[model samples]
Target: MDASSGNSAFNNSVAPLEGFDKDMLSSTLSQTQALLEHFNISDIEKILNMSSRTVSVMTQCYCSGTLREILLSYKSVHGYFSLVVCVFGTLANVLNVAVLTRKEMASAPINRLLTALAIADMLVMLEYVPYACYAYLVLPGEINMPYNWAVFVLFHCHFTQVLHTISIGLTLVLAVWRYIAIRFPQRSHILCSDRRCNVAIGIGYILPLIVCIPSYFTFKIQATVVFENDEMIVLHHVGLSRMAKEDDELLYYVNFWIYGIIIKLLPCVVLTVISCWLIKALYKANRRKQALKGYTNCNSASLLPSEKRAVSKSDRRTDRTTKMLVAVLLLFLITEFPQGILSLLSVILGRCFFRTCYYLFGEIMDILALLNGAINFILYCSMSRQFRTTFALLFKPRMLAKWSTPASQTDVQTTYV
Candidate 1:
């Protein structure tokens, strides 16, 4: 019954009927009537391809009432695929949280952020579940949502912009924590402890809303017409607020540029620099340890059979966590790189040829973002010894007795399995 958790069947069945108004709705209804008349989904696609302004106008005037609205919305196999992806991502996130929220889980500053992120991803999943269900059942022309183009754009895309901004920022927060832990291990306890870490996450989530509020007030979206000859598609323009005219489209692109540089590129640089420093320091420490061993055979070609022993799984995972963060960053760059380029192109190049590609391109990035959330559990298990032990105790309380083994005796990664 918690509002934060499940997506009930009742909500799904009645959502279309709940929000419609006697005078406030008609857009989808009209489309549905037209769709029923045509009985062909291709017609809806062709209509969808038209300008945002055209679609807005067409929907605004759609005759009120009835079902079987736009068939094109749910008719595609792609829509089905999107729904499945969203469902899988949501369920994975839920499982991840359930695994982590146990009473026995060790409370660390680092784990607090992990918990916060899991909660955020949970919300992300919650948002997408309804979206997926809508895609499955409510075609664009059939979806009974009202047609206030201004309100719709403000509510959905703007909100997503805020979340996207937060997502990028959280990654950097983790990167900074990693950098500090590795490069300045002496100070790690003070800077990365539970209290400070919780505050850092609290502030990180808060800052996004404060920064993005201007966009909410200054931005306005309405259906606009883009015509080349007789072909026109309804376009959504993010411009100045109601009755205001400003070229903030450039600002939107700039916002993205700022986000990319500050959140993604800068953290990547900081982490890379810190990681290299850690490697050099570790090398020096290893050299000192060898020197103290009185085994100073600098010129000797050595074959130590002891060094070839297979590493314990926990050590393997700890090292792998460092590498994984870097690798995931690279993967993120690869996946999002195209979207950023094309997004800039949409604003700077102003090419009509590329506009239609935006949604398709963006959904690709969304999938990567979703994937990013999905893999974080593996990252935690690799990086944090505490997470592995606690995760084990979640589903197996009997294992709690086994965890009492002295640190030297414990096999961290093996405990999880």
Candidate 2:
């Protein structure tokens, strides 16, 4: 009975009655004929044409077979995949927050930004669950709840845009922080303090909220016509307000500049420039270090043990952390750029412009963004030795307890003897 095409009784129950409209139209026409002379001929013609067009559109099915297949496939496969990503991504980000918040790592400027990034990613992932349900479960025609869908789209769209913007902004800040730290080491402490970084992160979240405030008022639910099994069905769809729809051109341009430029393009441009400079600075520093190899080796014995170890460990960790962050920045750019481009096109060219390909591509870009958030922890794990060690320690406390047991201690004593 739940099947789209296999239920005969359900289809019959929804089918139109034969001669029903004809009988009603006969009575209405008979009554209208009595007042035909009172009405203008042109007005009558307009009314009939409007009715015909409305009927034609209502009886026409939207979305093609291939599009339905794609939707179904995405719902069955990607929906669950996205669910997994959100769940695991949330856990990973929680662990990232836990590990980075420890006393050992908490005070550093980069760690502060990284912690903020984890929180932002976690919020985005949490928001993804409803969005995935909207796109995959509800959109595939399994459920019909237009009002709920409209309300959720309003909140989900705004919250997601804000959270995603914050994540990107924090990343941009991180890149700039690293650039200053490496290229201008003396001023790094002054320019990139924890207070300043926190302020920047705050601005990152707040600016997006201010920018996306208009969305809350612009969207509304509209009744849309569709045909299934030759039966006309009216469904609710989310659309812009009457005012915005009337002045759609202006709205498109405004959104293109506001959402496209400020939210997406600007951060991308900043990150790219900063990333390039960071790379160049890193390369130059490596060459300089290589040139100082023999001099450093000769002077090594002249320094205290702690000082030598600190310098070596600090330099290596700084380079690794910077490189890891740069990788995250690059991956974010790759995953998110498409959605920004799509937003501009969707607004300017109209949502119906791409048809099936539009939905397919939009869904793919969304998944990519989700993937970007989901993999940040992996980047940290792979790139930072300290992160890996800390993560292991946090997750494997029982093993450490076993290593400190009396029998293991006695074994160590026997080996020393």
Candidate 3:
């Protein structure tokens, strides 16, 4: 090649790269490394080291890799398996939402409150839970695309927290509504209505959203807090990345206590106390009413035995609704009450004391919360015969059984909550 042509070609095409001799390339690489050193992620190295400790832990969990750690990281098989299992939860919650909202509940305040809860739970399951299952369990370690990260963070901070809090508050609302129904049935219509119940449900969501806004600032990727003694705290907490100071950790935990007390404990305690009172009142009223009924029956015993059976049937029908509400309250206590008591226990005893038994205990309790969403449908179905008739009407009007079944008056199941 001519010297002039070679010179022109070198300068024109490779001018920017002409300086990258071995020495220059080495210098450039060193400079780039210096910049990366400032903000490089140590997440993968730390995670790999932590996985061995999972053997000592009770709630063992591990990711396949930090996008590169696990060999089978991107397999569709794992995704398929996760989808199959988590889909069950999604299906169950959807059924609950559909049943509660679709059924035409009788015009009662309790029904109104329960209807709101059903809708909220439905929104929760549909919107947040499925994504959570995959993000936390199914995905390759530390899935960090900007878009998915944004979606995951929003679900964790806003949708999941808001829905769970609202569901609990709505449960309390249902309990209080029942208390009013039982303790002041005479004034119940005046004090509680579908419209008023609607307002309360709306407020329940608004209050939780106000609290969870802080969560948006705090909530981050799920993490573990292992103490010096090796007790692992495996749940979601505020992101440490956002916290500027080391001392702020104390404030983070304190914030949890505040949220727990107000959102979980206070409401449960209040509802439990009120529920006891309502149950007592219901029992007493039933006793007195039964005694009077017996007295009337004795006086007319000689005159009309058939009429006595008729009265008994009517009384039974009316009490049916009460029986159904009792069942619902019992279910709530079974699922939710344990969770509150366990929270208090964990705080007092500390999570490590009992050999990490608290983690399992909490998991069991979480199932109850899950079931809270699950059983609303069942409660509605078993209680209001009118709801049954109406649901049947909506789904299959042509198959309608003419005339509702004779609901024993004592068996008059109406949603009090």
Candidate 4:
């Protein structure tokens, strides 16, 4: 071969390698820039370690190679799951409202409050489906969804926020009512009347509306421009994120106390404390009843059988309802505490503290909170024999008719307690 031909071949090979190196370097710089823009970090090594661990788990469980893909998959699955909960929750709560408002049940104050709660739960479930769809299906795509739909979904936040407040307030009222009944039984007759329950329900709706005025302003939809596919697109998002980004210290502090403490933490603590007391009262009452029955052998003349039976049955019924409600309270706290903690931390430390992980965790926490409403009817049915019978009769009349003789009417008493 000629020297000239050999030299040309070497130059061609070296030229291609130089182009490849430039391409690689450019890609690396762009990726680094994007990472820095998204994450504020003093320690790149710590972020890298956290990313490595998160990526490994994401890859192993979801078979996704990128965090974007992992998040999309996560949102998609949970979004559809949330829709299912919305449908089922709506149906269950509708049934709850129907059964609890019936003449047989509506005479009692507790049933009236539960009926209101069912209405609140139903509204909450209905509101969530659109929000989840917007976040997962619309936000990720960024261009496919119509602008009108995006605006409507974003605006739905206000209504959902009101329902959220009402739901929490109603649960708190239930805990307080049960506490009053167990702690001060004599006052319950006057304090827990239908008039008082109606007043409380009115307060539950109005008070939440009043307290959430600031939240209505804080959580409004925001419009901003973004470059996608080298074209500018306008996007709408919840104002909370923008507020967090702007580092509005006063708003963050307000959110930390209002959303974190009033809406979440206070209710959780109240529920826990009241539930403990109710359980203790039940145990003591049971012990006293047992003692009475045992001592009746020595003082059978002093204690009337009718009085003994009435007191024992009344105590048992109260205990059963209290136990069921305690279960509801515990479930609410369990599902919601993560979100509460995240809200507080996000406010105290700023959104950059946990980066993407915080947002992802927040999404999961939202689904869990929705699940609390979805499963409440199941808890009621499982705990209350009257509720189960009413539910069976309402939904499965022919099935219930096969076994539910006229004699069963005597057995299935009302769920007044």
Can you give the lDDT of residue 90 in candidate 2?
Answer: 91
Candidate 1 runs further than 4 Å off: 1-78, 99-105, 135-137, 140-145, 148-153, 218-244, 247-321, 327-331, 351-354, 378-386, 397-417
lDDT of 1: 0.47
Ranking by TM-score: 4, 2, 3, 1
Against the true structure, candidate 4 reaches a TM-score of 0.75
lDDT of 1 by residue, 220-297 (tens): 544434333345434332334442224644554444444444434554566556556545655665576567545535
TM-score of each prediction: 0.61, 0.74, 0.63, 0.75
lDDT of 1 at 110: 50
**Clash count, predicted structure 3:** 18
Which lDDT value does model 4 have at 24?
Answer: 35
lDDT of 3 by residue, 1-417 (tens): 000010000000000111113333333432433422221112222222233264245222322225223312322233344344335545655554454554344355566566667667666555545553554344333323243543454444456567777877777777777677666868988788768877897898788777655434443443432222243322232233344123654444444454456656787678678767767766886888878976775687475776777766555544555556666666766665555554455455543321233322322333445566666566756765655554555556554545445542222343222
RMSD values, in order shown: 10.7, 12.1, 15.7, 13.7
lDDT of model 2 at residue 398?
85
lDDT digits (tens) for residues 158-235 of candidate 4: 566567778888888999988888778888988788788999999999987777555544434444443434555453
Off by over 4 Å in 2: 1-76, 138-143, 225-234, 345-357, 398-417
lDDT of each: 0.47, 0.60, 0.48, 0.60
Question: Candidate 3 at 7: error in angstroms?
Answer: 70
TM-score of 2: 0.74
| Model 2 clashing residue pairs (backbone) | none
- Across 296-352, the per-residue lDDT of candidate 2 in tens digits comes to 999998999979876776677667867887798899788766666655564556533
Ranking by lDDT: 2, 4, 3, 1
